[model samples]
Target: MGGVNTVNGMTGIIMLVLWALAFGATAFALIHALRQRSDAFTAVDKLTKPIWSGILAVALLLLLLSFGGLGLLAFISIIATGIYLADVRPKVDEVQRGPRW
Candidate 1:
C-alpha cells in the first residue's frame, strides 16, 4: 500500500468508486471521439480527432495513476471529459447528424 495507501476499508471503497468513475468517463470520451468523422471536429471548430484522442488517452492514464497516489488528478481528467461531452460532443453530433431529442 505504498502509492495506493489509503486510510482503511471505507476510504478504500470510496477511492475505488472514484477511480471507476474516472475510467468510465475517460472511456466514454475516447470512444465517442474515435467514432466521429475527422471532418466533424473541423466543422465544429473543436480539437482535431487525434488531439482529442490523445487527451482522452492521457485521462485514462491519469486515472490509472491513482495506484501511484495521484488520484487527485482524476478530477482534472473528469474536467476534460466534461468539456468534451458538454461542449464538443453536441457540436460533433450536430455536424454528423441532425439535432435529436
Candidate 2:
C-alpha cells in the first residue's frame, strides 16, 4: 500500500508539472497572438489566431482533466497541437522572418 501511495503521489506531481507547462504554453501563445494581431504582424495573424485559440482550448481541457474530469479536453489539445506543429507553423514560417528562427 505504501508503494502504491508513493507511485500515486509521483503521478500527481507529474500531472501537475504537465498542467503547468500546458498552461504556460497556452498563455504564451495567446499573448503572442494578441500582440501579432496588430498591424505589425498582420501577415501571420491568420495563422496565429487559430493556433492561439487551439492552444487555449487544449490548456483549458487539460486543466479540467487533471482534476479527475474526463480527458476529452486533453485529447482536443493534442490534436490542435499536432495540427499547429505539422501544418500551420510551417506555412507561417515560410511567409515571415521572426527573430527566433
Candidate 3:
C-alpha cells in the first residue's frame, strides 16, 4: 500500500541520518585532534584514548554487523575517523605541546 511504502521510505531516511551522524562524529573528532595545539587538549586526549578506542572498536563491530543492513561503509569510515581521533590525535597533540612547562 502507499502508506506501507511511505513508512519504509521514512525508515530508510532515518537510517541514513544515523549513518551520517556517526560518520560526521568521527570526522569531527579527527579534525579536532589534528588541529589541537594545547597542553590541556593533549592531556584530555591521553586520558580519553582508551575510552575512545573502546568506543571505536564497538563502532567498528556494529559496522561489521551492518554489512548487509544499512550504512556499513559509513560506520566503517566513522570507525577510522575515531581511530585518528583516539590514537593519532593524542600523539599529534603531544608533539605540538612540546616539552613540559
Candidate 4:
C-alpha cells in the first residue's frame, strides 16, 4: 500500500511531467543565454550577456530545488526564464542576424 507521503496515480504523473517541463525550460534558457554573443544583448538594448546568463543560471538552480512546486521563488524563476525566452531571445537573434529588408 502507498504511504501518506507517497504520490500515486494521475496526480503523481502530472507532477512528474510538470517538474520535467519546468526543469527543461530553465535549463534550455540557461544554455541558450550562454551560447549567445555578448554584444547581441547590448545591440538589442537588453541586459548584458553576463547578466542574462546569471539570471538564467539562478533560475535553473531554483527550478531544480523547487521540485515542481510553484513556490514564490520558483515562480519568479519561471517568469524570468519565460521573459528571456519569449521576449529577449528574438530581439537578440534579430540583432545577430541583421534586418531582413
lDDT of 1 by residue, 1-101 (tens): 85456457667787677678768878988999999999999998887999999998898788777652335687888888889989999899998996678
Question: Can you tell me which runs of candidate 2 are displaced by over 4 Å?
Answer: 38-70, 85-101
Give residue 56's error in model 2 in angstroms: 3.2
Cα lDDT for residue 34, model 3? 38
* Backbone Cα, N, C clashes tallied per candidate: 0, 0, 0, 0
Model 4's alpha-carbon lDDT is 0.86
Clashing pairs in 1: none
Candidate 2: Cα lDDT at 91: 51
Better of 1 and 4 by TM-score: 4
- Candidate 2 residue pairs in clash (backbone atoms < 3 Å): none
10-70: candidate 3 lDDT, tens digit per residue: 8888886776666556546644643455454445545454454455555655655564345
* Best candidate according to TM-score: 4
Tens-digit lDDT string for candidate 2 (2-73):
999999998888877776665555555545444443333346555446555656565655756655332667
| Clash pairs, model 3 backbone | none
The TM-score obtained by model 1 is: 0.80
Residues 1-101, model 4: lDDT tens digits: 67643645657678768778878988988888899999999988999999999999888888778775667778889899889989999999898888998
lDDT of 1 at 49: 98
lDDT of 2: 0.56
| Predicted structure 3: clash tally | 0
Q: How far is 38's C-alpha from truth in model 1 (Å)?
A: 0.4
